[model samples]
Target: MRPSDRVTLEDVARAAGVSRATASRVVRGDTGVTAKKTKAVQAAVASLGYIPNSAARALVSRRTGTVAVVIPEPDQMIFSDPFLTQTVQEISRDLDEADIQLVMVFGDQSGHGRRAAKYLRNGSVDGAIVISHHRFSGQVEAIMSVQIPVVFIGRPVAQASPNSWVDLDNVSAGRLAAERLLECGARRPAIITGSLDMVAAHDRLRGFREVLGRVGIDPVLLEGAFTAESGRAAGEALAPRIESGEIDGVFASSDLMALAALEAWRDRGLRVPDDVRLVSCDNGPEAAAANPPLTSVDNPTDILGRAATDMLRAILDETWDGQPVLVPARLLVRQSC
Candidate 1:
């Protein structure tokens, strides 16, 4: 029998009828394994649902007096995204308290993960904090090669992602947004989701779907790249549907997206809460500053950032008990809905 979230490499090896070393070689992308054994290992992994543990990859106890904060995004995004900046700031503030230096690494577009991986493999830092990892970016493989104490700001979209992380209850946040829309007596509701490559975005979408499904409202789903440009694009796309009365309410994935939707609707001469209603996630200053004031789900970034740092520090100190922290998100209702 296979265990969930605790499947070990050794178990996979035994199930595959190969030596543990051989299984390790395959998992690490070693090309030395024979074709017959490689097929067996693949079948075993799929049947048993084996999840690779990053913490077990040649974990070495070392102190480098520094920690790396890796953001897998371009410089322009680093400068514009308040969420990313706040995450780094909270981590930096916490690290400064313990006299640890923070080295910011930008793992940007195409092949940047490899460069980031190369720097990390040099054993230059005691630990690392990874944020905004995407699917197929190869960032997961890159970070796993380091063997340092690493923590993720959000769970990566990979089966081999490290288990340790502190994050908001995004499902609850999505449900809060959907509930707010329904409470306002909206007849036709829709959702604008963030990039599905991130686990938080998927969780938020799932929660929204679950809540709306229970009430017989099949929401119109729109995807966004978690950027202002994408948000504006989504808003423009929704304008036509709003005019046809096909979408009378919206659950935007972020405050920025919600504000963009407000602008789009206003430009179309539609009044919020009268012609359409809007609720958003990531309650921030912009939400409060909107013309009608947006109702939003608050995923406290400060709590998540500090909690992740605290978990990383505990891992560094050998005092961690291996429990994950899940901070609940709350809705801040305003006039927009």
Candidate 2:
């Protein structure tokens, strides 16, 4: 090739010893190429500095070159919840690297989900990544009818056969948090759960229950909406039990909830770890900086966001495995417990 001439896919194919069609497929992010051929094509593309034409790729793939991220909550919730905010930011960053636009859509109960669903079905985007897919919601029902490739950020309750997803291992996190609280001398423990509608809340409660069952004791269940406000309310409601010594330990489903509850308990003149031991999940930055560092489980929302975006790409490429991906969870020890 001349020095001034742009490197072509043809040159890449020849250098990689693969057919022109194979080279094109690899350049466009298709995973159907054999492992050996893929590696060869990658090496050739890098060495030759071959830039895949985005326009040409769109023509070949018959795609709009954009993807939608459907969130099943109102705008306020997404902005207020750090976990959701971080997840969206990570997904946007990952998609931006590939020249893909991330469209945010709300699918809450406010009748906006129907409009979002209509927009999704209109073929405006190449595919979709849904977050917090609540069951029986209008948005879910409408979006489920779309024929394009779709993936979920978390394990959906209504994931039909072949629905792609990525989620944190909440059950193990719950178990770890429960064990830590018990080890710290928590006898009459309670578990503050997230929204029961989401599968995460159930999984956490299940894991916590497993640990409590070992001692033949039942856990006190407090339902929250994975929000600090909900956590505060749950904490304030526990004034009676906390003061009466009915509940001495607590495992809140999310760090946001745990932190808010801690404040409320303190307002009620209760001391953390001294009055009642506490544990939480999602070892986000806030957890470490709390008045007393939180003993929590590490459920990195950024990791979940990136994995979910990757899953959507695989689906669009028609090379996705049918298996769901579960990011592992572990415990982070600190002063609270």
lDDT: which candidate is best?
A: 2
Q: How far off is residue 292 in model 1, in Å?
A: 1.9
**Residue pairs that clash (backbone atoms under 3 angstroms), model 1:** none
lDDT of 1 at 228: 79
- Distance from true location, Cα of 58 in model 1, Å: 21
Off by over 4 Å in 1: 1-62
Please report how far candidate 1 places residue 171 from its true position, in Å.
Answer: 1.3
Put down candidate 2 lDDT per residue, 18-91, tens digits, no spaces.
99999988887666899999999999999999988877767766888899989878677889887888888899
Compute the lDDT of residue 247 as modeled in candidate 1.
90
How does candidate 2 fare on TM-score?
0.84
Ten consecutive residues with minimal summed lDDT in candidate 1? 54-63
TM-score of each: 0.79, 0.84
Could you give me the TM-score of model 1 versus the true structure?
0.79
